[model samples]
Target: MSRFIPLSVPNLKGKELEYVTKVVETEWVSTGGGYINEFEKNIAGYLKIEKGVACQSGTAGLHLALKLSGVKYGDEVIVPTLTFIAAVNPVRYLGAEPVFMDCDDTLNMDLDKLEEFCRKECTLTNDGLINNKTGKAIRTLVIVHIFGNMANMERLIDIAEEYKLKVVEDSTEALGTYSTEGRYKGKFAGTIGDFGVYSFNGNKIITTGGGGMLVAKDKNLIDKAKYLSTQAKDDELYYIHDEVGFNYRMTNLQAALGVAQLEQLEGFIKIKMENYNLYKEEIDKIEGISILDFNKNTRANHWFYSLLIDEEKYGLSRDELLNKLNENKIQTRPIWGLIHEQKPYRNNQAHKIEKANYYIDRILNIPCSTSLAKEEAKYVCDILRELER
Candidate 1:
């Protein structure tokens, strides 16, 4: 059997080893070192954001964003249910609840339903913020940029502003993606909203082994996130503590790898886009499968290539196709199961999940690793062709 094509994986060819080796040689491996500082600067410089906070994981970044958004114990946060639960779980971490919204064709937050849900399920207070029917202030909106394709940021931001809500961008899947046309022109995914979070997990466009970055337009917010991530320590040298804080700092070793990975991110993104194009070209001809597309106005990172299976036309269920691919060692998988349906969040608020269901049932993620060579792409395509037959 051929080597199994993975859905996503890290590609570290440049200075990953050299930087990690330097960290080891220098013995600053635990945390807080030159590499962490350099990695933060590199991220801020790359995205041109006001500031960035390096954290231990993307979920940690989200937790900080939620806290910065003023999400308290009794608050409600509007979140898309179609995304990875990590995007919504942070709400729970803050003792807040998530009011789940549906996704549009872009597999992003459905703007129309988002508006309607806010309108129907909420009432505007004198401050112009939407309050849930139960009167929990809908204080923030968490928008996940699923698969490196953006949510309707223009409309979502407008909604957020009108409702006096904070916007937390879960750009964990959208590191290098941006809007080509908008009020936030040329702004990167995580930078457009009130707060943005990114992941550098093993499967992301770039990997820091285990790291993520948080960005914001406000310096105070960035500082606060950094403070919160560092376990809210009052004094560093004296070990004085005024408030609770977490050890969510990304280590120097991770940051060293991040610095190298950031340098190669654009090139990695190119490979993702190219592989997506080839997948479209190869799979569009197969019956019962439709290539997923991004919104025309935006330039996506093309991080994940999705094929929506039309069971009616293709004459096979999505799981059946998934099983077939797995049996053939192609390593394809489904889009995330809706967050609302997850075991932990099964009882959360959900509004108009029709389109999200439509998407989740049919989408298949092909091998989208940057390191996946052209021959691998051909092999996966051939297996897909065989599956269609």
Candidate 2:
């Protein structure tokens, strides 16, 4: 393995150059361009949503969604501790706090504990669901589909409705995931919630250099999110501003790349799924480690493949294997540290985060780029087997 296998990287072997060239030729490379609108439409159409609004990044889209979800100052949002911090930071951006929730076997928000928290720890009032611990309104829940795997949306949504909590689906890692057997069958990850957001970062399933899209069940919310992303211009002709807004508009260049990337998205997903299955087969031959599968009820995009390592059985610790693989020119990364354990969020309320802590130290993300070659994957597995020996 002379070449280093990257954990993840964008696959841009399509009309990306052509589309970006068109944007440059038409001099529409800024925020305004035909490609931006088309990209939004293509994304919305793919997800079977009414509309999609492009923003500078997923974090910005989440911030706008949190604002629209009516998470006012002092409001509380139930978030997952096992996910990237971006999923919970938007709550702070809106002057609200986040009550961190634990992860289940799927590495998603534990719906059982979530229900328990609502039933035993909180009370529903006229204002909203009030958290008895903080005496603040529980206004929303941010559900992140970890590693392109769809969470148990069927149960999560029921709990949300029963508790009157607005749902925001952080589908940043799950753009192509959709339910197959449920009431929301055929509903995409982002479309099932009140608001869903997708990331087009360089390392995501797709890339637009760096950008995101926001979709919602209601047209007005999507429209307003679009407006707020572009500085909330009430009257464009006179440049009149109506409210505090963010300059979070995605560039025409990025959207140009996005449209081209979206065209190849399904094909990319196919390759990713195939590679994931291949890895699963090879890794299963080894002892003390296993590749975790996605929820069988949904079709996942397979953005990342997580390896569960049992140190005693594997003969090597997770950190030891990580270092060995990287030294052998294979890139691997540990799962994110629990959000509640981070310094900035340590003092925030965290509810029974047991499984998250357990998996955080054992889960390792191996190379899973859409463009990863079969030989490279085999090379990666060969190294793992060597470590086991």
Residue-level lDDT tens digits of model 2 in 166-222: 999999999999999979889899898899999999999999999999988889988
Instruction: Give all TM-scores, in the order shown.
Output: 0.97, 0.99
Model 1 TM-score, all chains together: 0.97
lDDT of 1 by residue, 68-120 (tens): 87888978888888888789888888899888998888888889988887777
Q: Give the C-alpha lDDT of model 2.
A: 0.93
List the candidate 1 regions with Cα displacement exceeding 4 Å. Answer: 127-132
Worst 10 residues of 1 by lDDT: 126-135
RMSD of 1: 1.4
Q: Which one is best on TM-score?
A: 2
Steric clash pairs (candidate 2): none
> In model 1, what are the clashing residue pairs, if there are any?
231-245, 231-246
